[model samples]
Target: MAAPGTLRRFLATAWLITRKDITVEWRSREIIYTTVFFAASCILVFAFGFVKDGRPIDDVASAILWIAIAFSGTLALGRTFERERYNETLQALMLAPADRPAIYAGKLAGILLLMLAVEAVLVPLVALLFQAPLFRQPVLLVALLGSGTLGYAAVGTLFAAMLVRARSRDVLLPVLLYPITIPVIIAGVRGTAAAMAPDGGEMARAWVSMLVFFDVVFLTLSLWTFEAVMTE
Candidate 1:
């Protein structure tokens, strides 16, 4: 239904937005530093609490990892939007002569990258602290993690952008985000657990498939609705 050249323009616009976000973030390091530090703190606290009971960290490692990402990622998403709002850049973006979907894609990409970086640090720390066999199937774990992260970022970016102009946005962001993202978190934790199991290949595959489905459904929906949501 769209012109052929539309896609190219959309992509170019998206790339520009992504580049701008990354450039600003690289200079300040505020989002990254806060996200990683919060995530690492969560991991350490959980590690200490769980060890008091002499519980096997492996059993709960997957849940802990997802928890770290969910909370830290939420924080990072809020900060990303706030930065744009504070600089009045979001208004500038809205007036630009680019497809709205491109803007959404760029925001999603930026937030997703931040979340993934947080995960990278958290995952290694989780493995080191909990002695999880996370690297046993590094590719599988990464795939599972990526799918879950993508799904979260897709919905999170949409809600965050929509709420950026609202009062109590920080309060509302997690409240709305968590309800929608429960499935992704569940799939991630279960898939990670399955991947860690000796006979979990088949189970992990099933969960990853669900993660993929969630990613596709939410991502497409976000792309479709971003224009209306952002304009409203």
Candidate 2:
């Protein structure tokens, strides 16, 4: 067990790092606005292209929703550490006198917060534009969002560290991330679709379980591997 002081220090460090991320975002607001705009544009394009046949927009709403989210999320995750790389602050953070996991946890928390905020905006916009029944089942929607976003963040955090050093970092993140995140996306979409249905209890439960399992597995893997990835 950690000593009281150790735990306190860890919490303080995590809080400080989280605050730094929020402060940076508050100053620019570029990432959030860009992500929201891209997401909305993607949904609008889908609405125009796919709804021409007079089909109910909800018919393909799930696919469109996830595609927008996945793409926007990739954009945000790629940029998460870009400022640090440009400014050389990541090395400073690594050299700080704190446990590595605290850094990782802080970053994870920040990314998760950003992701949830993006989704909060995107979900309603997509639903409104596509006429999908998004709020019909708030509980399942919450579960799907929670599990899927965590899984995306888990892999994304590590890749953000890795790609920060690469030449094609922006392009590389999605190429690396998409293959790994398919399972989570699949589970999320299925769970969300079922949750939107009146008789979707069992399906929703199963997909949520799969999502939870995926979250636990990838989260552990990301935490364990983050130190090595960051160092390399």
Candidate 3:
């Protein structure tokens, strides 16, 4: 067992990395804006192409929403590590005075925060554009989305680190990430759609539990495997 101070220091290092990533993002504001734009475009395309049949947009709203998130989220993940790779900062991070899991946690936190921010902009935009009832059960929806996003971000961050050294770094993250993330995405969409139903709270709760289970399981697995992945 680690000492209390040792654990605290580890957490502090993780927090520092998380803050650094957010600070860099705040300076540029590029990733959030790009994600929002991509998300908006997805909404517009789906609205034009699929909403013409006078069908309830809610029918496909969940799919549309998650797909937008997944696609745009991939862009954000790819760019997350690009700057470090470009500037050779990753090597410096690897040499920092902290355990490797701390670095992984920080990167995961950063990616998760970015995803949440995009979702913040996305949910309202989606609701307004499609007239979907996303806001009907905000609390449950948020809980479910948060869990699912964290799971996705966990795997995404690890893969980002892995691909940073690859020749096809940009192409590799999603190719490796998306297939693994499908279950989380499905659970998320189902949960969101259930939350939209008249009395879907029960179903939503079940999905939220599933999301939490997925998050915990994968987060632990990712943490344990991160050192190996990063060193390779």
Candidate 4:
């Protein structure tokens, strides 16, 4: 077991990092607005292009929703760390005496909160625009969204940190992120689609379970590799 003082320091460090990122974000408000607007526009474009004869397919709604989230999330993750890289704050943070994993956790929490905020609006907009009966499977929808977002953020945070100093980070974030996160994305779309289906309860449960499993695994992997990647 860790000593009380050590535990307190760890928690305090994590909180301070989170608070710092939040404070920065609150001041600028750039990422929140950009991510939300980008996601909303994607949803509107899909609605316009795919809503056939004044009606959209229920099956397509889930796919569209996840796609919007994925794209916006990629953009948000990249920018979150890019700010640190540009300002040279990431190196300063690394040079601090705080725990490295705490820095990773703080960053992960900040990015996750931003993405969730974006999802909060985007989910309902997709439902409204596509006429999806999303509320019918409230539990399933919440489970899939939470797990999918958690897993995506976990991996995205690590990769974004790694690519922070890269020249082509804007293009590379998605290229590296998507291939690894395909399982989470697949589970998200499948779980969402199943929830929308009339007899897809069992399948939805399976996909949600897979999402949860993936979240645990990927988050563990991120935490394990974060310090090495950040220091290298």
Per-residue lDDT of 1-232 in model 2, one digit per residue for the tens?
A: 8799998987888788888999999899988998888988998888888776655555477777888888988878777788789888988999998887788778878888888998898888778777788788898888888888899888888888777889998878888999999999888888888887888878988998999999999988887887788786
Worst 10 residues of 4 by lDDT: 49-58
Best by TM-score: 1
Identify the runs in model 4 with alpha carbons over 4 angstroms from their true place: 1-7
Per residue, candidate 4 scores C-alpha lDDT tens digits across 1-232 of 8799988887888888889989999999999999999999999999998898889965899999999989999989988998999889999999998988888988888888899889999989998999997777888998889899999999999999999989999989999999999999989998999998888889999999999999999988998899899887
lDDT of 2 at 152: 84
The deviation in Å at residue 52 for candidate 1 is 3.7
Q: Rank the candidates by TM-score, best first.
A: 1, 3, 4, 2
**Order of candidate numbers by lDDT, starting with the best:** 1, 4, 3, 2
Question: How many residue pairs collide in each prediction?
Answer: 0, 0, 0, 0
lDDT of each: 0.92, 0.85, 0.88, 0.91
Estimate the TM-score of every prediction. 0.96, 0.93, 0.96, 0.95
The list of candidate 1 runs beyond 4 A from truth reads: 1-3, 53-58
Candidate 2 segments whose C-alpha is farther than 4 A from its true place: 1-8
lDDT score, candidate 3, position 12: 95
What is the C-alpha lDDT profile of model 3 across 103-155, one tens digit per residue?
Answer: 99998899899999999888887776677899889899889889989988888
